[model samples]
Target: MANDPIQQFEISKILPLEALGTDISFTNSSLFMVLTVGVSAAFLIMTTSGRGLIPSRLQSISEMCYEFVADLLRSSAGSEGMKFFPLVFSLFVFILMANLFGMFPYFFTVTSHIIVTAALALLVIGLVLVYGFWKNGFGFLKLFVPSGVPAVLIPLIVLIEVMSFISRPISLSVRLFANVLAGHITLKVFAGFIPMLSKLGFVGVVGALLPLGFTVALTALEFLVAFLQAYVFAILTCMYLNDAIHPSH
Candidate 1:
């Protein structure tokens, strides 16, 4: 039914393609992902192309994004983390744009799918692992062994740290995927009520006011959530990168 809130997440293939016995079709989700990348890249490139001293509104936004992610990285990982600014910044922009795009009717939310968020989470963690070992060598193992602890509990602590490190991607991906999925579903469910009640003439229309109010409020909240989730993901990425940079610290 048109009122089905969960239907918003449906992924349909736009162009059917197959290769090596695998379905590699272009999908609505894929389109939105591409659109998100294209739009964000274009906006940032064009807005900052002028390099104006007195920045235009678009340029100001672009600058703000750059500075915001930079500050977030520096705060979590210190000056050393600036080297990963491009990765963190791209992630923040991509997630923020993908989330905002979903606000439009009929647009698919790429991050709403666990597969997408999981891949991002894995990428961050993968980098952390590769860099941590490469930079520190076996000294990277120091990450799981805290500096101060009783000898008896050292093994236990290491095990705990190892598990916690292993769970990073799972937590990161679920946090983003779940928040986006729930928020959109709730917004759609409430929004569906607006038209349903209106069909019942004046009395029903009057009754629809409650859900209408809820829908409006939810829309506002979802926008905030979209930004917050991006920030949270980026900050966590910085923290993980910090461990890679200074595993023993």
Candidate 2:
């Protein structure tokens, strides 16, 4: 029924197509992803297309978002990290737009999927590795070795650092996927309660009010979470980039 929480997460093919023995069909997730990127791009362009000494509301919102991510990168990775503004800004805008789009009824949440989140996290880590090696050469190996450790503990510390480094993508992906998945599921559950409670006449209708209120409150909170998750992801990306830019401490 409409109350089934997991039903919201179902990925259905929109235009079934296969190539090279693989299911390369277009899907609802793909649709929303396109929509997310398109809408986000348009919003930025429309808002900032015309410059003004005194900004309009839309321009102000766009500038705020730009500064927010820029400040975050500058603070976390230093002014040297400004070179990565395009990457970090793109990630933040994509995630924030995808999440907000998912908030609408009948929309698919892309970031709620582990595969999508994992891909994004892997991209960040992969870039870090490539840049770190390219910029620092073999000296990037110092990232796993602290300067002050004793010879005896160096081996053990290096082992721990290696493990932690390997786990970055896993942790980053799971953090985003889990939060989005759990929040949506919880929202659905509470929302489902309203219809069920309303089936029992007067008392049922009154009880349904509670769930309705909760649903509204949860929806509001989810909006905040959507922005926050994007912010956290961007900031974390900056920190990882910092490691790449200055690998040795």
TM-score of 2: 0.96
lDDT (10s digit) by residue, model 1, range 157-196 = 9999999999999999999999999999999998999999
**lDDT (C-alpha) at residue 38 in model 2:** 92
Task: Output the lDDT of residue 26, model 2.
Answer: 94
Query: lDDT of all the models against the reference?
Result: 0.96, 0.93
lDDT of 2 at 221: 92
Residue 33 lDDT in candidate 2 = 95
What shift in Å separates residue 159 of candidate 1 from its native position after superposition?
1.7
TM-score of each: 0.96, 0.96
Ten-residue region with minimum lDDT total, candidate 2 = 47-56
Candidate 2 regions with alpha-carbon error over 4 angstroms:
none
Which residue pairs of candidate 2 clash?
Answer: none
Regions of model 1 farther than 4 Å from truth: none
In model 2, what lDDT does residue 164 have?
Answer: 92
